[model samples]
Target: MRLVLTGTGASRGMALGRARLEHPSRYLVDERPLEESEVDAEAERLYRAIAIARDELQALREKLHGALAREVAEFIDAHSLMLADRELTSGLFELIRVGRYRASAALKMQRDRLVAVFEAMDDPYLRSRKEDIDHVIGRVQAGLARESSVEERKLAARVGEILVSDTVAPSELVPLAEHGVLGVVLSSGSQVSHSAILARSLHLPMIVAAHQALSHIQDDDLVLIDGERGEIVVHPAAQDLARFRAWQRELAQKGKRLALLRDADTRTLDGTPISLYANAESPADVAQARTLGAAGVGLYRTEFLFLQRKEIPSEDEQFLAYRDLVLGMGGLPVTIRTLDLGADKADASGLVMDDEENPALGVRGVRLTLRHPQILAVQLRAILRASGYGPVRILVPMVSTVEEMTSVRRLLKECARDLRSAGHEIAEHIELGAMIEVPAAAIALGGMIKSLDFVAIGTNDLIQYTLAVDRNNDHLANLYDPLHPAVLKLLAQTIATAQRAKRRVTLCGEMAGDRRYTALLLALGLTDFSMHPGLLLEVRETVNALHREPLRAQATALLRAPTRARIERVVENLKKAVG
Candidate 1:
């Protein structure tokens, strides 16, 4: 029987392989009370295990290089530090000495205490750190038992198995890829998770938030992963397996055909030019974007630089990172968004206020940056400095009011003037843009566009804010509709306002990347799109097949639709016409 499981797709591709369940709990030691005579030996075993785990992490770090590797290595190094922590190491030994407990039991108690503290915090980012603690402890526990991780052992035995786990850390991805793992399915993760990013980079199929996959899936059961649709079929029936195999073959043929259109300019049948850009977080992503024919980077998220760090990055450090990205783009224009950190994306720099009851609606994005002007100033200076290398633009995220835009512009001027005073050779003209993500910003687009050089409609947050639903909350996911009449109206108004202002606007969100929405967006007069690199070729193909006049006509009717269902029907009809 074919049992289908649904999840959020984090990467794009398809894979068929036998299941390999990664049970980290298998390494956990029994919490048995130890006799006084055996306590000394158990304590020594714990210390030895900690030493081995530290050495293993160091070895892993030494074998890797590059920006992504450095980021992953930082986490691994943090794990090594945990193993070396006197409180964690010595405390476990002390517990074993006093309580006559086994070393594993002592370690488990300490881990529970630390995890409880993190769980009690109001910040989701801090709470998420418990996963890292769990991973490190799991490694040490495995070392104590003198066994490799279940993942490592399974990979050694089979080359093309699909890995199923509760959660996968970014650091483990390289090893998994090297072992030729076909795909990954996780019980928990988001599209923005480090593992997802690495998986996408490696071109590995991955599904996240597959809540029951780990429990329901048995080892060696044949599984099919549809990364595009976020579907997993376990122990698929013969007929279903044959159908999926045919789909896989078709997908491969389609990919090869799409490759032919890679070098083709992004334009409609009527020769209407559309600017296709890539959204990137790190400089390493530039290579992939360029390969996929991105005109430039439309949205360079700066938050990743702030994440997983103990302190705020210095101005020079940020400048170097920004400069590297500009240089990597080979003179292509790059719009670097200022730090969009808050809520679950909060930094560990101690500058963020994480005590808010509802972080999503609280101080975040430009508001948080404005509250901490010093941090904003440093970032502006770095961005301005990087602008000297190539074409660079500044983008402000989550702007709701004209007042916030005015404040940011003022600060940008101050930073530019100070840099000039210091004899820094900056770009003569760097365009400043506003991200129309908030409903208020979209509603007041006329005033907002007047104060900005360009605009980028961020549909992800725009939909979330307009619908008053958190897309991350599973219970509220059903309410998160991007095709709502109100959302379509806002998008149309935003594009119309930008067109009126004679300012360039780009749709740099998930909607831009989805092929299903390509026709609707084109009909809405969105000529600029910035999205994940993987979708570039497919989106370009869709654009190439489109005729501007017909799409525009279809879009007019879509905007007039009364309900979400009507809008979707119109969109579906348009897609068929164009596709």
Candidate 2:
């Protein structure tokens, strides 16, 4: 029996010959459809690839003797959907469009484009997605190089979870995501990479870079990947494997416990109601939002629809997207943030500038739309027209100056007039808001908070920018602390200002998901929280269990603590008292 040493996901392969622990043979997998196939062949090929990958995963699961938990299965299905995404499949045709290139050439061209797309980005989250594309490309290229025929092939018997490397297109990963078989390893992935995001969505485990894991892992070697820890354990010892099996069961139990709490209302034993909402990016996620018992959709990020499209997402496209979300909310509030993408999110839609050197400080969010009047006009028209469908409000992101907000409102009025002229019945359904992500915006909240309809705090960017840290770097990640007193002071100040002015205030950043801060936030006298849909119930339950008066009192004192360490100490004490 081979002894396995675990580390992280996608990095779990057997170490090969002793001399070359750094490099392993990479198995290439690329698919080409024959010209004789019918129009439906593309979909058929997608499902077929998923089946091949799934079968490989099934073998591993069987050998595990049912010890691998449901979470592991979620891991498998995530890969299946990736193979089915229409966007990635569309790339195949796009690849053929340029000089009728065959499979290998098309894959290579797409690979280069994928990297270029990410290279242009400045945000670490979106920039990370670029690496996911790189992984997909490796698979497509390998499939092309190894298999010359257009015919389908089963997983090679010799093939044993070999590290597949290349630029993975978003489209190709769709089918894999649906099917959930992520045996493929990525050499490079970005936070914005659809594959990595998919992993987060379905609860799959994957490791981005373990210094060329493919070179170390042998084909089909038994491996354990710790996604949360970012380590892959290969051929683990008996005791270690047993411990992991127990850990798997423990986490599963915790998940079930969380699930049971989902339906429980977020009310304390004494009757204080907590408003819980999901932080979402797409119209499609609203269903998940509702299922999580969220009071409403807190921060509906509307950047993705416009980001990858070649043309400005036409008014009709925007209208349909907005209409779907507004109607889906079923009267629940849907706070839509308009085009928050910076250099962090690269768009070839001919509307955005590709400033490589400094995208974070470059033209994006409200600044982009204000400069491109036509782009703002198109989106505003869609928002207003769709406002008739259901509850919809506009939230602008990246506001460093009030002038940016003013320019947007001027155009919005112009759009409303045009809609009314066209005989569209419009009530006062739209609410204008701004996202306070920059330190400057937070400092100016006293004045800016009064001028806006609502103010949303984007803690992710606020923290990164305030601390002058690139969160993606391993060395600097520790600096990205949510518990920093500086961040809390900014949040408290902005919320207090908005409340004083009687304007709505919501926290839409990941901090809202930190259940530890529920009492503290409540003590700060804030009511709105928008976070990941999955975490909504857990956070709500935490809030519901608290005696608001005491929690508020303790949190008040905690906020006054001098150092981050003391703040954490207070947080721990508060959590213990509540539990």
Q: Local distance difference test, per candidate?
A: 0.82, 0.63
What lDDT tens digits, residue by residue, belong to model 2 across residues 317-341? 8888888888887888888788765
Residue 489 Cα positional deviation in candidate 2, in Å, after optimal superposition: 2.3
**Top model by lDDT, which number?**
1
- For 399-439, candidate 1 gives per-residue lDDT tens digits of 99889989999999999999999999999888988999999
Which has the greatest TM-score? 1
TM-score of each: 0.82, 0.71
Candidate 1 worst ten-residue window by lDDT: 149-158
The list of candidate 1 runs beyond 4 A from truth reads: 1-12, 34-103, 106-140, 143-146, 149-157, 187-202, 207-216, 228-238, 304-312, 343-348, 354-364, 467-481, 484-486, 556-564
Residue 507 error, candidate 2, Å: 1.6
Off by over 4 Å in 2: 1-198, 206-221, 228-233, 237-242, 248-263, 514-520, 523-525
